[model samples]
Target: RTNDAVKTKDAFRNQAARLGFGTPNLLEATEYPLTRLTQNWQLLNSLYRSHWIIRRIIDVVPGDMLKNWIKITSQMPPDALKRFDSQVR
Candidate 1:
């Protein structure tokens, strides 16, 4: 059964941890593929939420100020954009 399989997997993980085979953090356990998938999913969900929040904040900005800000940013050099992107990330 699925439940038995999960229990067996957990038991193996616990035993491995007891023997110091891996980190105690379940999310960092690469032996389980689901952990990576879960981390990626969480990252994507966080990005989606951040994008939505930024859009809402942009909507609240005054039209003229927003336009001026966009124009200034558009005039920025590629290096400047890269630095800004890194800082944002």
Candidate 2:
């Protein structure tokens, strides 16, 4: 929870074991952990961008999505925001 690396490692290992990789520990399951994190990041980033574009088009998106987007904006660290904004502009 809350960006805890140990939890991240454990979840990564467990998921990999389910997929039959049988990695015995975090070090062994390195790729599995990265794959899982990357997959989730892709999903969240895509949904965020897609809904953002759609909302601009129609001037509306669900209230919940808008709220979550606003919260996510603050959740992003300053360096991350600057890097992202640089790409945008």
| Prediction 1 global C-alpha lDDT | 0.60
Q: What is the TM-score of each candidate against the true structure?
A: 0.19, 0.19
Among these predictions, the greatest lDDT belongs to 1
TM-score of 2: 0.19
The parts of candidate 2 lying over 4 Å away from their true place are: 1-72
Candidate 1 lDDT by residue in tens digits, 3-71: 554334443345645543463665555574344544686776666577987556656766656564532
* CA lDDT scores, all candidates in order: 0.60, 0.58
Misplaced by over 4 Å in model 1 are 1-73
Q: lDDT (0-100) at residue 34 of candidate 1? A: 42
User: Going through the candidates in order, what is the number of backbone clashes in each?
Assistant: 0, 0
Extract clashing residue pairs from model 2.
none
- The residue-by-residue lDDT of candidate 2 on 1-89, one tens digit each, is 49755534443335645542464555655664234544686776666678977446444545545554432357888999888866754
